[model samples]
Target chain A: MSAKGVLVRVSTYAALIVMALATLFPLLWVTSIAFMRAPERFAGTPPLWPDHPTLVNMVNIVHQQRIGYYFLNSLIVAAATTPLSVLVAGLAGYALAQAKFRAHRLVSWIVMFAVLVPNQALVLPLFEMFSAVHLINHYAALILPAAANAVSIVLIQAYARGIPADVLDAARIDGASEWRTFFSVVVPLMAPMLAAVAVLTFVVSWNDFMWPMIAMQKVDMQTLPVALASIDREHYQNIGLMAAGATVAILPMMFVFLASQRYYLRAVSAGSLTD
Target chain B: MARLELQRVSKLLANRQVVLQDIDCTVNDGELISVVGPSGCGKSTLLRCVAGLDKITSGDIRIGGQRVNDLPPQQRNVAMVFQNHALYPHMTVYQNLAFGLRVRRVARAIVDARVRRTAVRLGLEALLGRYPRELSGGQRQRTALGRAMLREPGVFLLDEPLSSLDIPLRAEMRRELSALHTALGTTMVYVTHDQSEALSLGQRVVVLADGQIQQIDTPDGIYKEPSNRFVAGFVGWPPMNFLDGDWLENSGLDAHCIDYGIRPERLLLQPSSSADAFIAGRLERIESFGGEWQVEISRNGSRVIARVAPNPELRRDNELRLWFRREDLYAFDRATGRRLQG
Candidate 1:
C-alpha cells in the first residue's frame, strides 16, 4: 500500500480505539471503585488501579443496604415486563404491518404520536392511575405501563414488513389457522426483532428509577435503581458503596446485551435502514 | 383429483373497483387449467380466491361437487405455490416440507416419512437440513414445490411460480411442473401473465382481460379461434397483426368487418404470381430469431409484423410482397372488438 493510504488506515483505527476507550472509561472507573476500599475510593489522587482492591464495599451494600432484596425486585419486574412487552409489541406490530384492517392507518398514526411523546411526561398520569387502583406498591405497576412500548412496536413492524406477505398466505393455505400461522411462521421470523425488543425492555425497566420510586413507596418494594438512590441519600460520602450499587445495577443489562448482541445489532440496523 | 368449478365469481375491491368480473370456468378431474391475463386483470386474484386466501366478493366455488366459498384455506384442502416461492427462511427444507402436515396435527412419524419422500421426489434430500437462504433459486423453487406436494391436496394453485427464474431455469421448471402434474393427476390452476407458458403447460387456457374471461378453451382452440380482438392480440408472441378493415376493402379483398387479424407466421414472404390476394409493403426492419425472422412491413400508414422463415434475399426498405390464405384471416367488428362470424 501507498504510505499515505497506510497512514490514513492507521489514523482511522487509532480514532476508533480512542472513541471506544472514551465511551468505556466511566463504566471501568465505576467498576474499579466498586472493588476499592473506602479510603482508596475517596482519595484525592486515586490511581486507575485500586491501591488495595477489596470486595468489602460490594458485601457491605448487599448486606447492610438491602441491595440484594432490591436486586431481586428489579429482576422480577424486568422478567415480567420483557416477554410481555415483546409479545404485545410483536403482535401489534405484525398487525400494523400486514393485517388488512380498515383502521390500520389510524392505529399507526396513534402509535407514531405515542412514540413522539416523552415517557417522563406520562409519569404523573400513570402514577395517579396506579395509585387509584391500589397498585402503587405492586410489580404490575412497573410491568403493565411499559408492556407495549411504541418504539419497540415500531421497530418490530419495520422488521416484520421485510417478511413477504405471500409466505404468511402460503401458511394459511397450507392448513394453518391465523393464530397458528402467526406463532409458527411470523413469530419465528420476527425472532431477531423480538430479541432486540426484549433487551431494550429489560434495560429500560431495570434502569427506571423515577416511576419505580413514585409507585413503590414501601421501603421493601423498591427496585434496584430506587434503592440505590436511597442509599446515595443516606451515604453520600461513601463513594465505594455508591459505586458498588451502580455496578450491580448495570451487570444484568450488560449480560443481557452481550448475550443477544448479534440479534440486537441486526434488528436495529434492519429497522433503521428500511421504512 | 377433483373437478373444480367457479360459478359467477367476481371480486370487487373495498372502493368498489371490480377486479374480477363475473368469472366462470371449470377444471375437470385431474385436468390442469392455466389462467392467463395481463397484470391487473385479476388472474392472481382469481387464484387467491380459489386458494381461499382472498374471499370473492360474489360467487360460488366448488371442489369435487362441494361448495367451499366460505371455508378457510386450511379447511378447503387447497395447496398454493406462490410466485415468489415463499419458503420460510427460518426453517430447514425438511421442516418446511413437513410444516403443513405438522400443523394439521399429523403424527410425527408420518410427517417425517412424507417429507423425506417428497425431498427424494424433488431431489432435495441432500439439502434437507439447509435453510431457504442457503439454497440456490432452483433449489428453493423445488423446496416450495415439495412443500406443496407434501400436502397432497385435491387441487393445486400455482401463481406464476416459474416467472422469477432465469430463462433456462424457467424452462427446466416448466418441464418439471408438467411432469409433476401428470404424475400426481391433481386438479391444478396455474396463473401466469406469460401466454407461452399458459399455452404450453395447461390443457385449457383461460384468457382474461380487464377483469373478464375473454375465452376459456383448449390451447389449440384459443390460439386458432380467439373469441375477440383481445384474445387474438394477446395470445400470440409477435402478437397477431391487425390491419384496418377498410384496407382489405380498398385492396379489393372481400372482408366484411371493421378489423382483420392475421398471425405473423401466416403471412407468406413471396406469393406465387397466380395467388388471388396479395399486399405489397416496404420492409421496415428484420429481426432474426435464429431460424425464424420477424419482418416489419409498412403499408400506407400502418405497420404489421410477419414471422417468416429467414430469407437471404430480403433487404431493409425493399418492397415486400405478403400473402395470406382467406381461411387464415380473422375478421373483427371494431365497434365491439368481437370476432365476426362468417
Candidate 2:
C-alpha cells in the first residue's frame, strides 16, 4: 500500500480504539473494584487492577441481603411483559400498516403523539388508578401498564411496511383466515423486529427503578433495582458490596443484548433506511 | 369450472372518489379474458373487487351462477397469482405449495402427494426444501403458480404475472401460461398494462381508461374496430394516426366528421400520380427496427407515423405520397370522441 493510505488507516483505527476505551473505562473500573478485597478498594491512589481478588461480596449479597428474591421478581415481570407487549404491538402495527380504516391518519397521529409523551409523566396518574383498584402492591401493576408500548408498535409498523400487501391478500385467497395469516405469515416476516422489541422491553422492565419503587413499597415485593437502591442507602460505605449488587443487576441485560445484538442492529438499520 | 360475471359494478373510495365506474363483463367457462389499461385506470382495483379483497360500492358479482358480493375471499372459491409472486419467505417451496391444502384441513398423505406432483409439474421438485429467498425469480413465480394451481379453484386471477420477467423469460412463461390454461380449462381473468400481452394471450380483451371501460370485445375486434379514440390509441403499439377532419375536407375528400384515424401499418407510400394518393408529406425521419421500419412524415405542421417493411431506397427529408383505402379509415366526432359511422 501507498504510504498515505497506510497512514490514514492507522489514524482511523487509533481514533476508534480511543473512543472504545473512553466508553468502556467506567464499566471496567466498576468490575475491578467489585473484585478487590475490602482493604484495597478505597486506597489513596485507586488501582486499575485489584491487588487481591475475592467473591465474598457477591456471596454475601446473595445470601444475607435477599437479592435472590428481588432478582426473581424482576425476571417474572420482564418475562410476562415482553411477550404480552410484543403481541399487542405486532397486531396493532399490522393493522396500522396494512388495513384500510377510516380513521387511519387520526389513529396514526395519536400513536405518534403518545410516543412523544414521557413515560415519567404517566406515573402519578397510573399510581392513583392502581391504588383505587387495590393493585398498587401487586405484580399486575408492573405488567399491565407496559402492555401497549408505542415505540415498539411504531418500530414494528415501520418494519412491516417493507412487506407487500399482496402477500396478505394472497393468503386470504388461499383459505387462511386473518388470524391465521398473521400468525403463519406476517409474524415470521417480522421476527427480527419482534426480537428487537423483546430485547428492548426486557431491558427496560428489568432496569426500571422509579415506577417499581412507587408501586412495590414492601421489601419482599420490590424488584432488583429498588432493592439495590434501598441497600445502598444504608451501606453506602461498602463500595465492593454496592459494586457487586450493580454487577448482578446488570448481568442479565448484558447477556440479552449480546445474544440478540444481530437482530437488534438489523431492525434499527432497516427502520432508519425506511424512514 | 364455472362462468363468472360482473354486472354494473362500481367502487368509490371513502373520500367519495369514484375508482371504478359501472364495469360490466362476462367470462365464459374455459375462457381467458385479459383486462388491459393504463396506470390508475382501476384494472387492478376491478380484479381486487372480484377476488373479494376490496368491496364494491354497487352492483353484483356472480361466480358459478351464485351471487358472491358479500362472501369473503375464502368462500369465493377463487385463486389469484399476484404480480410480485408473494411466496412466504420463511417457508420452503414444498410448504408454500401445500399451504392452502393444509389450511383447508386436507389429509397429510394427500397433501404430500399433491405437493410432490405440483413440484414436478412446475419443475421445482429438486428445490422443494429451499426457502423462497434462496430461489431464483422464475422459481419463486412457479412456486406461486403451483400454490394457486393446487387449490383447483373455479376461477383464476393473474395480475401482471409476467411484468417482472425479462424479455425471453416472459415469452416462455406466456407460452407456458397458455398451455396451462388449455390443460386446466378454467375461467381466468388476466390483468396487464402491456398491449401486446393482451393481444397475444386472451380470447377477449377489455380496455379501460380513467376508471371507465372503453371497449370489451374479441382481440381482433378491439384492434380493428376500436369503439372510441382512447381504445384506438391505447390498444396499438405505434398508435393510430389521427388527421384533422378540416384538413381532409380542404383536400377535396368527403369527410363529415371532426377526426379521422388510420392504423400505422395501413398507410402506404405511393407515386404522386396514383389515383388513390390522398396526401403529400415530407419524410422527416426513418428508424429501422430490423425487419420493420418506422417512418415519420410531417405535412402542414401535422405529424404522423407509418410502419412499413424495410426499404433500402427510403431516404430522410424526401417528399412522400401516402394513401389508404376507404375501409381502412375511421372517423370520430371531435367534441365527444365517439366513433362516427361511415
Which candidate ranks first by TM-score, i.e. highest? 1
- Residues A63-135, model 2: lDDT tens digits: 9898999999999999999999999999999889988888999998898899998989999999999999999
TM-score, chain B, model 1, is 0.97
Every model's TM-score? 0.96, 0.94
- Clashing residue pairs in candidate 2 are none
Candidate 1 chain B worst ten-residue window by lDDT:
B245-254
TM-score of chain B of each: 0.97, 0.95
lDDT per residue as tens, model 1, B120-149: 999999999999878988999999999998
Q: What lDDT score belongs to each candidate, Candidate 1 first?
A: 0.89, 0.88
lDDT of 2 by residue, B187-277 (tens): 9999999999998998999998888999999999999889998898888879998886243654565556467888889888753333364
